[model samples]
Target: MEETVANFSGSNGPDNISGTPGADFIIGLDGNDTLFGLGGHDRIVGSGGLDFLVGGDGLDTIFGEDGDDTIQGSAGADRLSGGTGADRIFGGDDGDLVFGDEGNDTIGGDDGNDTLNAGDGDDRVLGGDGDDEMFGGGNADLLRGGLGNDLAFGETGNDTVFGDAGNDRLKGNEGDDSVNGGTGNDSIFGDEGHDTLRGDDGNDKIWGGDNNDVLYGEGGQDILWGNDGTDSLSGGDGNDQAYGGGGSDSLYGDAGDDSLYGDAGNDQLFAGDGNDLAFGGAGDDFFQGHDGNDTLKGQDGNDTMFGGTGLDLLLGGAGNDTLAGNEDADLLRGEAGDDDLNGGSGDDYLNGGTGEDQVTGGAGNDSIYGEEDADRLVGGDGDDFVRGGAGDDVVLGNEGNDTLRGDDGNDALIGGADDDMLSGGNGNDELQGGDGDDTLLGGDGNDTLSGGEGNNELTGGEGADQFNFDGGITTIVDLDLDLDVLDTSSVLGLDTALSILGSTTVVGADLDILGGDGSLLTLKDVTILDFADFLGIDIDLLNSDLGIISG
Candidate 1:
């Protein structure tokens, strides 16, 4: 039968009202009341005071009406809804459904994996710590997958969905989604729009779909993909792999042995720790091998590279390039175009082929060679060897035992640190030995020599000579000796005549010497000197010095 009950007075609820079919409103006097809908789909409303309603047996509808009410659905697949005011709805036994409408409400699935929906406002939906399903609808909602694998959906607005310590599936749908894969292998998806997905402390798989997304694989070896658009991917700890699929992207393999790829467009790749490999697939690129042994290649376009630590190899192919080996032992080669190479630390080797280039070995035992064109070379530290193969070049040995040579063209050479050897092979050159015992030669052309430290040997051969020895002894040995008897006067001029007389004095003899009017004079001893003075000097200095000049 169809029955209707209405109360004008705002009372709590009617104490103990039981009905079958028809819509019912059981009102209570300012006290708590209990109502049950036994048959047919019925709506029961309790106004003002606290009340309790149960939709029992049939497909009944029970509302917790107004005041703080407790509603339950016992048996039968019924729908229990809670009214405005703080209320509690329970799906007791059976696969029942419950919705806590408006006001702050608590909804739980008592038995049989039930569906609990919290409608409007802030609400709490619990799957009653069972293998149940909960939905936090509208406003700020909290859904907990207490036990068992539960599917929790945070619809619209901002929501907190937790797979609380179990293998659960949580999705942050629409609005801004915050999901935590608490203590279990959970699958979380931040679908559509801008979202934040974190694989918190597990081997989790996360997808930051569309828009600009931030995906963080917090711990463990996690897989994260930035699908479409520009995205930020970080593989936090563990050996992680990251990919920047499209757009200008940033990928960081924070620690452990990580592999990073910049696929298409100009992208930035950072392989932060462990032995790492970085690739700048296309376009102009920048790469940093922050730590561990690394391999960097400037695959295309003009690129700049830094080999940060450990032994590294850098190849600059095509385009003009700049390579710096920041620390540790490294090998650098400029394959094409004019390039600049610097070996910053450890024992380094640099080869610049073709094009005019500049190369420096910043520290450690370094070897540098220039293949063609004019080039600049610096052997920075440790025992170093430098060769300027062709064209006019400038080579400097900054420190340590060094060997420097100007192979061709007019070259400038500076020898620094420890004992060093320098050769100004061809062309007019300048050679300086900054410190340590050094040997320098101006092999060709007019060259200048500065002997920096220790005893130095210098030669200004076949050219006008100037020699400076700021420290240590310098001995000038005449390499051009007049062994030709026919050309004695040309070799032994006034200077040679005085040198001969000084040599005789060293043997405890005093000899007075005089020069004849443009005629060569040789004073062998006192007897030969007096006889030669009386004969008026000239029987040819070559013959007299050779003992052919006799009194």
Candidate 2:
């Protein structure tokens, strides 16, 4: 047992101490005591019994006069003080300064670069490492900046802030606050109520003050600003930029080369890649150009548009409308409402002027024209051209090498591939031809034909009749009747057999006028005979392995 109380003054003895070591100057003349500065550089003082103080190394100074005290600065460079009750303080190494002067305190600046303050009730502050700065002076506080490059502040109640690594800065000064910038290169600010901001990596900057706010820019090259209420902004990668400054806002440019602006109310914009540009400056807005080579503008209220890839340009200036150009080489216009248009890929150009409109050309090589209401047109892919000008209409040319014309309604025409031509000029009509080499003309209903490939020549002129062929060719003639009247139902179903007996009527002898009922007969001249009882049915049929019919 050892005790050396140098210059120890006592007004009321036994302020509770078990101290008997060298170089000790413990002073607590009043009721509180538990002062152990057992090693060198020890100067401990607790003028009341709610105190336990230890400054075991050089450069130490500890003091807690009233109740509620625990001060620990076990190494050099320490100075802690919670002179009033309700205090717990720690500054264990070099560069320490802690003060929780009034009640409700837990303050720790546990290593070098430490300075902490929680002076009022409901306070918790930690700035434990180098480059640390923390201040939560009033009630309702919790602040942390535990690594290098740290600065945190939640000076009033209803506060929680953390800027845990290098390049950190956080602020949530009043109530309704929460902030985090937990990685390198961070900057966060939500200075008033209704605040939440996160910018967690290098190149981070976020600001969302005033009511109704939320902001996030979680990676490098980040800058998010939703400075007013009704805000949400996200630009979480490199080449990021987002600004939705007023109420009624939502902005996202989540990949590289992003620039989004919806500066006024009634706003929504998304352009998440390189070569992106979106602007919906005033109210009533919706815009999406979600890939490269995009330009969208819906500057006033009553607007909706989407042009999601390269070669995209959409503009819907006034109210009442819908427009889409979801792939390359697109241009859409609905400068006023009562409009709907889609040109979803390369080689697309669509226009639907004045109210009452609908237009579609959803693949490459497309062009559609439907200028008024009561309109519908479909021409999707290369070699498509559709024109349905006035109201009451339906027009389709669904594949390459197609041309369909239906100038007025009560109309339907389908000619969907190469070598196709369909025209139904006036009302009351239905026509179909969906493959190569097709031409169908039925300007009034009660019309039907199925000849969808080459060598298809059909004419079903006036309503009441039906003619069909899977193997095409039909002809019948009687010039006088001779050459043995060509037996076997006219030259034995001639797949190649033409016999004109006399008057030198046998032209290279190759004919098949199918009496075998395979139904393909067109023998114009059985070797040039305007003579021999003119009973002509040699019907020239040459199938020398199906070649040489080029015209």
The candidate scoring highest on TM-score is 1
Report lDDT (Cα) of residue 202, candidate 2: 77
- Cα shift from native, residue 343, model 2 (Å): 3.1
* TM-score (all chains, Cα) for each model: 0.59, 0.46
Put down candidate 1 lDDT per residue, 1-551, tens digits, no spaces: 34443322234435777765544444444557777766545555555567877766655566666678888877766677787777888887766677887888888876667778888868888776556777787877877777666788878767777767566777777666667666566677766556667767666666665666777777777676666667777878877767666666677778877777666556677778888777666656677888888777766667788888888878776667888998798998876768899999889989877778899998889989877778899998789999887888899998888999887787889997788888887777778888887878777766667666565666655565444435454433322222100112232223323112111221334333333333233333221232332212355643354333333
How many backbone clashes are present in model 1?
5
- Among these predicted structures, which one has the highest lDDT? 1
What is each predicted model's overall lDDT from 0 to 1? 0.69, 0.68
Stretches of model 1 off by over 4 angstroms after superposition? 1-140, 192-194, 227-232, 245-252, 262-273, 280-291, 294-324, 331-341, 349-358, 367-376, 385-396, 402-551
